[model samples]
Target: MLLIDLDRFKPVNDLYGHAAGNAVLCAVADHLEDLLPVNGIAARLGGDEFALLVPFTGGIENLKRLAQQVITSLVAPISWNGGAVKVGATIGIALIAAESDADTVLHAADLAMYQGKREGRGTYRVFEDSMDTELRERAALEAELREAIEHGAIEPFYQPVVSLPQRDCVGLEVLARWRHPTRGLLGPDQFIPIAEETGMIADLSYHLLRQACLDARSWPSHLLLAINIAPQQFQDRDLAQRILAILAETGLSPRRLEVEITETALVQDLEAARTTLTSLQNLGVRIALDDFGTGYSSLYHLRELKFDKLKIDRSYVDTITMSEERAKLVDAIIKLGSSLGLVTTAEGIETDASVAWLSGQGCNFGQGYLFGKPMPKGEVMRMLQAGPRLEQIGISSMPESRIHAVPMEAIIHCGVGRAA
Candidate 1:
């Protein structure tokens, strides 16, 4: 038994119409029928989902090959009204046995399909006993995450982003940490995916943003607050408007907030991203292309989007000191940022050597544990109060007056923010 789900199918219905979407689904059904084995039966399970029952005495590799074929068939766009509709599929396979009930088999295949989706969509997975345990744990975690978001248990932590050569803390990146009652502090890796999958990301994100913005109001005017926007959130057409509303509510200056977007978000819908980003830019919000050089279309994004900053991915930063090739890549990226008149921030900077190398390469900013780990609001406030030592972080001291200059109008009660 194979359970298949079409990826990005909603966009077809949304962009073209139900007719075009139906055409795509019918096309998929035809392709599945052509590939079915002898005595194989195929049926639509409704809403872009399909099921196939095949009696196979063959090896598992044969089943894998069939799955791959199904994936490849959809690679070519479906022709519709002189336009092309594109979609992909993720399949979950389960072996039928005499003892397996219909509900049990279907549940196993469904779990496997979701696993495939989570591991980067457009793939296949065979049902496994371990997947059942994982699903249960995920469900439990999802419930906890919802409660966490509702009661403000998931809070933002701040990591300092400092000027490269100067080493003065110019801004802080918002990273989310869940203050679990029994488990203690939980990193974003624990709950962010669940939030994204369950359609809770928007609410979770806005809650964090509201708190982060309120917290930022207490920082110096010169200091900026950088928040990463998730790829899933880009699907929201009114993303810019929602952000504008938050800034208005919190009274955080638009100039002091930087929005970090990944290449994944840009590639999903470049035109839509452009429209949203342009709206934000027009309102004084700075944008940074985060995790640079990791994505396939980095140069294309640079050409298409007017980004204020380029963040060199930590993978390159982690090996620059040890690997000559990585060092050169880092150097090239920094020079690219400089030539494009964009500030470059190197992520995962740990050693003084890495810091020196980055500064020498003309990188504008640095962020990582060597500066300071992500801390809560009170710790951030204290750090701002007591200027960091030059000897400790290999930079000159920040001015005392600049550190203390939080405007009277901007003072407010603090709250948590960000997914790191």
Candidate 2:
């Protein structure tokens, strides 16, 4: 049995409407029908996933070759509604070995498919016994995530965003934390992708939104709160209405809440994403292009989406001081955001040099451990009550003024005494 997953399916579904998504599905099914033998069965397993039951009479290499053929065939874009959509599939094969039942075969093939996804998709994997443990652990994590939501085990942690020009905390980004009761605090990387894969992201998103809105309501009125959105949640027709309702219930102004979405998430279906973004914008919520510069389509999206803010990805921020290329990229991004009249925030500002560099480049805002790490809501509340620590300084006051402000004599005297 061979199972194929359209790895890039979500973008197609998100960019086009479900109707166009259905068309792509039908097209894929038609292709499979044409390629499979008379006894083979091809079935839709819903939402960009398909299953193919092929008789186990062939060698594994033959199945791999077939998968490659399917991938190559799909390289051509599918025409739908006056536009073309491009996508690819990853296939997993499990030969019906002796003593293998349907469940075991399916499980093995599913693991193989995931292996393909890990290797960058558009490929295939044959079942191996070693994958069984990892698959089971993932299944367990998925189950645990569902329970975590029910038991209120997932909590919101706030990471502060500092205004570089003012050196004062202006807002907080609400990040999800999974407290496993026994496993201590777990980051989103541990279970979020599984949540998205299993279609639990919508529920988790709403839960976080409600919690974040409630927390922000208690904070001082001037401070803003930003929350991340999974692309899957955008599929809901009433997402804008739901967000507005949450704001109303929490007594928080829509303007105080910012929604951060990845560039990859928005480029999947430009038209549908535009419609959703327009709806959210009408609700008075600010939208930011989170993790910018990581995707191939960031520049194209910036022009198309007209986002309120641009968040520079950490990969560039981390090495900005060491690499002239990275520094130039940051400078260009800051200039781009300024020209577009959008606020730009750099993430992963861990050192004073990096912070100074960003400020010198005219970047307006930043978030990173150098400012404050992600902490629980109660801790965030306490910190907010403590008020802003450093005063905000302008771009002209950076590097030179900062250096002049420090006592150079003290450093010289300390070095002299140590050398003696």
Candidate 3:
């Protein structure tokens, strides 16, 4: 059995139309039928994908030869109303072993086809044991994750965002944690991609955001709650309205609630993004561009839309002390934020020197492992209670701007309790 995917087929539909795309697919079917053996069965497994089953009693070399022939045949340009349509097929071969079942064999062939595409299109790859096992494990994990969301196992854990030089705990970044029944606790890095792939990311994010708001509603007004929003969530036309409802239900003040948008989210649909973000701002809630430099369109986003803050990505911050160029880049980013009036935050502030250097550069905020890891509500509450006390600041810890950053020791002492 061989699986084939037609490359560049989408361009025909985009450049021409679906009618032309269908014509190209039909041409591929014709080519497959012509190339396959007399006893072979050629099946159109839906748009631009075809499969062939050839009963072979010979060695693997024969299948290789047949795959190459199919590739050669597909490479020939098809005349569609006198316009030449060109495409190539990536082939994946799955040989039937003694105990192979129909579904398993087809899955192996599908994996092999993708492998060929990854290795480079217009080539063929044979399925390997590891590939099949990995695919099956991923599928199983996806199913488990879907069940976890329904069971309310995914929830928010927060990491603090501290004020620079002063090191005051000004806010917390809400992060999702999956309290899996069998797997203990799993962080976003472990399950977020699966959630995104399964189309459950929106649900997961909303659940966390609403819960975080409810939890933080009673916190001191000065301590903001930042929720990370995914790009997928913005596809909904009523995203802003839905957030309004969440705020209303939780009684969390919009002023103290910050929504952080990653670069990936902003670049997805600029018009929709601008409208949604503008609506969000209209509600008096602050917005921050999260992981600033990594997105596709930073300059355009800054120019066309408004942001309350810019969180510098960790990549640049990590190299500040190690490389002069990186240090200068960080300096420039801080300066840009200052000029544009965006509250600049240095993300991933790991060492004391980095914190000192960022403060010297006039970064407004800092977040990283040096301050704290993402923890449960109770632990965060304790840390919040420990605010700007000299003990929390290590009694003598001071930045170069310690005189100007007068609130460093006292501000970390801000306390939070249940609303009475």
Report, for every candidate in turn, its global Cα lDDT versus the true structure. 0.80, 0.73, 0.75
Which residue pairs in model 2 clash with each other? 15-269, 165-393, 166-392, 167-392
TM-score on alpha carbons, each prediction: 0.78, 0.74, 0.70
Ranking by lDDT: 1, 3, 2
Report the alpha-carbon TM-score of model 2 versus the true structure: 0.74
What is the RMSD, in Å, between candidate 3 and the native fold over all Cα? 8.2
Candidate 1 lDDT (Cα, 0 to 1):
0.80
Total clashing pairs in model 3: 5
**Residue-wise lDDT of candidate 2 within 346-389, one digit each (tens)?**
88888888888899889988777776566687676566555345
Judged by whole-model lDDT over C-alpha atoms, candidate 3 comes out at 0.75
For candidate 1, the per-residue lDDT at 242 reads 96
The alpha-carbon deviation from the true structure for residue 4 of candidate 1, after best TM-score superposition, in angstroms, is 4.9
Q: Ten residues in a row with the worst lDDT in model 2?
A: 411-420
- Among all candidates shown, the one with the greatest lDDT: 1
**Which segments of model 1 are wrong by more than 4 Å?**
4-52, 58-91, 99-103, 119-124, 388-420
lDDT of 1 at 136: 91
Sequence-dependent TM-score of model 1: 0.78
lDDT tens string, model 3, 1-420? 999999877656754678898888888888898888879999998878889999875788889999999999999998887778888899999998789999989989999997787677999998888887877887888998888877777776766667778776666666777787777887677778667766888777777777787777655655556667777777888988888888888887676667778766665556777888899888887788877887655887799889888879889998899999989988988999999988788878788999999999899878777876666776666654554522223322222111111331211111010000
Separately for all candidates shown, the number of backbone clashes (residues 3 or more apart, or on different chains) is 2, 4, 5
Candidate number with the higher lDDT (2 or 3): 3
